[model samples]
Target: MPHLEEHVSLRPYNTFGLAVQARYFARFTSAEVLRQLLALPEV
Candidate 1:
């Protein structure tokens, strides 16, 4: 499974540096991996 993370902060990713949270966060290397992650219930 992809390295799934919940409630991940978006501050570093944000250009404005605002404290935002993502309900779910994951990085996929390929389309198949992305499909797998998207298949998860939480996604």
Candidate 2:
């Protein structure tokens, strides 16, 4: 499995207009699917 850094932040790259750190992250297209996926044990 792959892992990401916990506390790194970047200012100029994220379109969300905030510097953030993600131990785990993903993008979702549907609200229902996102909720279901988040409820999964593997997530």
Candidate 3:
């Protein structure tokens, strides 16, 4: 599996000073949306 860092960076955009950011980030209002995102190949 590809490492998350390979696709994302936290050096500039991260406000919390975390070591990394999600290569792909999303917010879901419901379970169905979460499932859909999880099913995407790019994710």
- Winning model by TM-score: 1
lDDT of 3 by residue, 1-22 (tens): 2222235666567677777756
Winner on TM-score (1 vs 2): 1
Runs of candidate 2 with Cα error greater than 4 angstroms are 1-20
Better of 2 and 3 by TM-score: 3
Summarize candidate 1's per-residue lDDT along 1-43 as a digit string, tens digits.
7788999999999899999999998878899999999888877
Q: TM-score of the candidate numbered 1?
A: 0.85
Between candidates 1 and 3, which one is better according to TM-score? 1
User: What are the candidates' C-alpha RMSDs?
Assistant: 0.9, 5.6, 6.6
Give one digit per residue, the lDDT tens place, for model 2 in 3-25: 22344555555887697665555
**How does each model score on lDDT?**
0.89, 0.58, 0.62
Better of 1 and 3 by lDDT: 1
Question: TM-score per candidate, in order?
Answer: 0.85, 0.39, 0.49
Which is better, 2 or 3, measured by lDDT? Answer: 3
What ordering of candidates by TM-score runs from best to worst? Answer: 1, 3, 2
